[model samples]
Target chain A: MPQIAISADSYAAQFAAVKRTAPLAGPLASLRDDAFHCFDRLGFPTTRLEEWRFTNIAPIVEVPFQAPAASGGLDREVLDALPLPRSGAPEFVFVNGSFSPDLSDPSGLPPGVRVRSLAASAAGGAGGLDVLTAHLGRLARFQNHAFTALNTAFLRDGAVIEVDGGVVSERPIHLLFASSSAPAPVLSQPRVLIVAGAGSEVRIVESHAGAGDVPYLSNAVTEVSAADHAVVDHYTVVRQADAAYHVGNLAVRLGRASNFSSHTITAGGAIVRNEAGVVLGGEGGECTLNGLYLGNGRQLVDNQTTIDHAMPHCDSHELYKGILDGRSRAVFNGKIIVRLDAQKTDAKQSNKALLLSEDAQITTKPQLEIFADDVKCTHGATIGQLDPDALFYLRSRALSKAQARQLLIHAFAADLLGHIKVEAIRRGLDALLLERLPMSGE
Target chain B: MLEIRDLQAGAGERRILNGIDLVVNPGEVHAVMGPNGSGKSTLAGALAGRDGIEVTGGSATFKGQDLLDLDPEVRAREGLFLAFQYPVEIPGVNNAYLLKAALNEVRKHRGEPELDAMDFMTLARKRMSLLDMDDALLNRPVNDGFSGGEKKRNEIFQLAVLEPSLAILDETDSGLDIDALKTVAAGVNAMRSPERSLIVVTHYQRLLHYIVPDFVHVLYRGRIVKSGGKELALELEEKGYGWLDAEPAAATA
Candidate 1:
C-alpha cells in the first residue's frame, strides 16, 4: 500500500502506518496482516455516520501518537500509590501494553483456564486465533470507527483467557493495564480475548492507569464470548489522568441461557470514549449494562453502547448516568436492536445526566430498533441540572449549599453504582468518586 | 421573637409584600389570610430567604439578626423554617440521612457535640412517632413517590425533627384531606411551645380553626391592606376579598 499522507507524528497517521507494516509474510504474519487489512478498509468514523452522529471524531483523528514505551514502565512506588485492587487478588499486569509474567499471578488458575499475552499468541499457534478471526471486530464494526479497526489491526500485547466448561473461579481476575506517557502523544493498543466455556462462570476487572505528565492515548479492544449457560461479570474503571486520551471497546457474544453484566465507572481522563457492544446469539440469554461517569474541568467522556438480539427469548437492560461540572462534556448513545427472528425480546434503555455548571454540556440518545413482531422495547434519555427544589430542601434541613449539591449529585450517580453486584468493587469505586467531587469547581 | 418593619418584597419585577408590618413574640401563633395570589406565600418565601424574593425596601428580624441577609440554610440555622406548599422529592437520598445531616450542621454551628448514628436514629424515631410517620419512610429516598398527604406529613415530620424557633407554614393545608389535615395540624400543635412561634399563611380560615391565630392580617395585591384580631379571618372568610378590590385604590394607598 502507498504511504499515508497524514501527519507522521499524529495518532491517526501513526496507527495507519502500523497497519501498513504488518503483512501476510508467514503464518504468524498472516494473522496480523489480515487484521491490518480489515483495519485499513475501515477507517476512522465521522459524525456523518448514523451511529456516530452525536460523536465527532475529527479532533481525535488529527492527533498523532507514538507507540507505548517498550522498556521502562511506571515507577513501582507510583504504581503502589494508585488505588488498585487488593494485591492478593489474582492479578495480571500489563506494562506499557505488554503483559509481564514477572508482575502477574500464574498459579491457581482453574482447569482449562489459559492466560497469555497477544505477543506470545502471535508467534505461536494459540487459543484465541480461531475465536479472534471469527468474532473479533464483528460486533464493533470498524467500518464506522477507524480507531477500533486500528486497535484490532496493530494489537500486540494484551490478555487472552479461556475458561473450561463447568468451571467456576473462586477469586476474581484483575487486568491492570498502565502506560508510561513519557513520549508526548504515546499510543497503546491493548487487545484482550475472553472465552467463557459452557456452564462456566468468571469475573473480570479491567482498569487503566497512566504515570506521565504529558498527553497520550490508550486504545484498547476486548472481545468476550460466553458459551451456553455461562455467566460473566465485567467491570472497567478509568481514573485520574489529566492530560491523556482513552478510547476503548468491550464487545460480548452471548450463547443460549447465558448471563452477562458489565459495570463501567469513569472519573478521570482528559478525553475518553468507551464503546460497548453485545450480541445475543442464542435464546434465553440476558444482559445488563450499567455505567457512571463523573467529569469536571474540561474533561470529555462519552459512552456508546449497542445490544443486538438475533435470537428469540433474549432480554437486555441498560442504564448510564453522568455528573458533569466546570466546562466538561458528556455524551451517551445506547441502541438496542431486536432482529426479525428474535421473538419475545425484552429490552429497556435509559440515559440521564446532570450538569452542575452553565458551561457544561451533555448529549444523550437512547435508540431502539425492533423487527420482531413479539417484543417489548423501550428507551429514554434526559439531560438536566440538579433540581432547585431538591437542593433547597436539603439545604433547609441544614446542609451547606456545597454539601447539598454534592450529595444530590452523588445520589444521582449512586442509582447506577448500586447495580454493581460485587461488594468490594462497588465500595472501591464509591470511595474514589466521593474523593473526586467538587473536583474542578471547588 | 420575630419582627417585620414595612417589609416590601416581590417575586420577579411584580411586587408582593408592600409595606407590611407584623410581629410574633415567643409562644404566639399568628395567621395571615388572603385570597389567591394575595402574596401570602410570597411572605413565607421572603421570610425564609428563598432565592427569587427581592426585598426592595424593608427589614425582617428573627431573634436579633437580619433574616433576609442570610441564605436559606443560614436562616434555618437562625431558627426560621418554611414548610413549602410543594416539597421537593430527592431520589436516592434517604430521608433519615438528610434529616441527620441538617441536624448535625445546625448543631455544629451552635458548638454542640455531633450525634453519632445511633443517637441520631433514636432522636429521629421519637420525632417520626410524634407525626405518626412509619419508620420505613426514613429508609426510602426523601419524599420520592410520596402522595400529597404523605408529602405534607413529611414536611411536618421534618418540622418536628428540626424544631425551629419560628416556623412558617405556607399553604400546608392546600392538598390535605380532612383526616390528613387534622393529623398535620395535630403535629404542629404538638410542636407548639412557649419557646417557639408560628406564622401560618393560608388562603382560607379552615386551617386557623385547628391552629388558631393570635393575629390575622388581610393582604391585598402586594400590601397588607388590613390588620385585626383573629376574628377578622372569619369576617374575611364571610365577606370575600372582593370588597378590598372594589374600594378605591387611592384610598388604600
Candidate 2:
C-alpha cells in the first residue's frame, strides 16, 4: 500500500478521518474509500504532472483552507454587481456552500422538478444522499484526481435538481455560486446532482462569482444523469475575481438516445480548472461540449474534457476556443475514448486559441483512443494569432486598427459562442468576450 | 489624379516593377495588359501601401499627395482603393457593417455627417441593386463562403460605398464567368465618372469589351513595352506576347 502523505493539522486530520468514516454507508462505501485513498496518495497536483504542467495548483493545496464559517450578512451592494440574467425570474443562489432561499426564487418550477439543497436533501429521508454517495467518489476514483476527493471530504450545501420524465420547462433554471467574505481563506464545496428522467428536457445556466478581495477556494462537483431520450442544455460561466481559486468537475451520464450539450465560459480566477466528463453508457446518445475561455493578467484557466463511449452508435463533438492575453496562460486537454463494444461511435474534437500578445501562451492537447474498428473519431488543436490579412482588409474599410482587431477576434470566438442554446447567456458571454479583448470601447 | 514616376517595387528579393512611369487623369480609364508575373498586381498593392512589398526607389502621387507615405487606411480615407484579385474571406464580420464603417470613415475624413443605420442600409441596398447583388450578401460575414462572382460583386459594392477617386482594379475579372464578367464590367462602368480615375489590370481583354479603356499599355519584363489607343489590346491578343519579345530595348527607346 502506498504511504499516505497526511498533513498534521487538525482540519486535515479530521478530513482524513472523515475519509475513513464512511459518512453515509451504502453500496458506495467501498467506492468512497478507494477515491479517498487515491486522493491521499496523490494529494493536490503540482506542475510535475503532465496534465497540471501549465497550471500550478500548489497555491490552492499547500495552504490549509478552513471550512467556510456561517455566512456573514452578504453585501447588498455586491449582489447588485453580479451579471445576472435579466429575464430569468426564478433563480437559485448558493453562497459559501449554503443555498440562500431568500436570494433564490423557485416559485415557477414545474411540478416534479425537484430543486433542493444538498444539505436539505441529505437530512430529508428519501435516500437522497444515497444517489450522491453512489456518484460522489466515482469520478475521483476513475480519474484519481485530488481536488474531487477534497470536495467529497468537505462536502457542503449545493443544489440537487431532479427533472421528471417527459416534462419540458419553459424558463431556464439559473444556478448562482457565490463566495462570501470570510475572516480567513475559506474552502467551499458545492455539489449538484441533476437527474433528468426519461424523455425530459431542461436548460441550466450556472455561474460562479466570488465576493470580497480576500483569497478563497471553491471546489465543486456536479453529476448529471440523462435518462433515455432525455435532453440537457447546461451553460456555465466563471467570472473574474482577483483573489479566488476555483476547481470544478462536471460528470454527465447519458442513457440511450439522450442528448447533452454544455457551454463553459471562463473569464477570471487566479487559478481555475474545469473538468467535463461525458459517459455514453447507453447506445445512440449524443453529446456536444462547446467552451470559450478568456484569460488575462497572471490568471491561469485549464479545461479538461473526457468523452467515454461505452456503447454503440454514440456521437460527441467538442469545440473549445480561447483568447489569452496579458501574460496569462491557458491549457485545453480533451480526450475521447471509444471502447471495443462502442462500435459506430462518431466523435470529433477541436481546440483553437488566439494569442493577442507575445507574452500570452496556450497549450492544447486533443487525444483520441479507439478500440472499435468501425468507429470514426478525429481530434485537432491549433493555437495562433489574429489573421493579419483579415485585419488589413478590415482596416482598409476605414475601421481603425483597434476596431479591425476587435471584429476579427470577436468573429474568431463567435464560432463556439454561436452554439450556445441560451440566447441571454450567449449574449452575456459575448459581452464578456468583448470586455476581455482590447476592443474599442475598453 | 494619380502619377507614378520611375516607380521601382519588389516583393521579397525579386523586383517585379522597374522604372515604370504612368499617369491617370481624372475620368480616364487606363488598361494595363500583361502576361503572368508582369508586376501589374504589385503596382496596385504598392499604390495602396501594403506591407512587405518594398518601394526601393521613385514615388507615387495621388491627388497631389504622396500616396506611398500614407498607411493603407489613411490612403483609403484619401480616396485610394485597391480591388484585390482574390478578396479575403473575413468570417463573422457582416458585409453591411463593414461597408458602413468604411463609408463613415471616409465621410468623417471629408468632414461629412455620418449616416444613420437606416440611411446607410438604404444606400447599401441601392448600391446592391446597382451591382445586381442579393440582400443575403449584405447580411453574411464578409466574403465568407462566397462564390467567385459574389466576391467580385462585393468588391464593386465596396467601390460604390467608398467612392474612391483612384480605383486600381487588379485582375478583377480573373475568376469571373461570362455572365459574372458582364455584371462586374457594368458595375465598374456605372461607378466611372469625371471625378474617378481607374487603372484596370488584366491579362485577357474580354473585360475591356464592356468597360472600354481610353488608353492601353502592354507591360513586359518589369516595364511598359508598348502604349497605344484601345486597339492596342486587340493587337496584343491577335499576336501573343511572343511578338513583343522580339523588339529590343534599344529599338523601343
Among the numbered candidates, top lDDT falls to 2
Candidate 2 lDDT over residue span A1-442, tens digit each: 1112433243466565554542544434455455556566666776788878878776666555777654424665676586654345568888877788877788789987878887676665676776566555554443467877767655546888888899997678988888865677777777788889999999898888777777788888888988999999998878746688889899999999999999898877888889999999999999999999887777888999999999999999999999888888899999999999999999999999989889888988887888999988988889899988887777667777887877787889877877877787778766765544522101
Clashes of 1: 8
lDDT value, residue A24 of candidate 1: 24
Output the lDDT of residue A132, model 2. Answer: 67
- Which sections of candidate 1 miss by over 4 Å? A1-28, A40-64, A69-72, A83-88, A101-145, A366-368, A428-442, B225-253
Error of 1 at A331 (Å): 3.1
Itemize residue pairs with steric clashes in candidate 2. none
Q: What is candidate 1's CA lDDT for residue A60?
A: 56
TM-score of chain A of each: 0.89, 0.90
lDDT of each: 0.80, 0.82
DockQ measured for candidate 2: 0.64
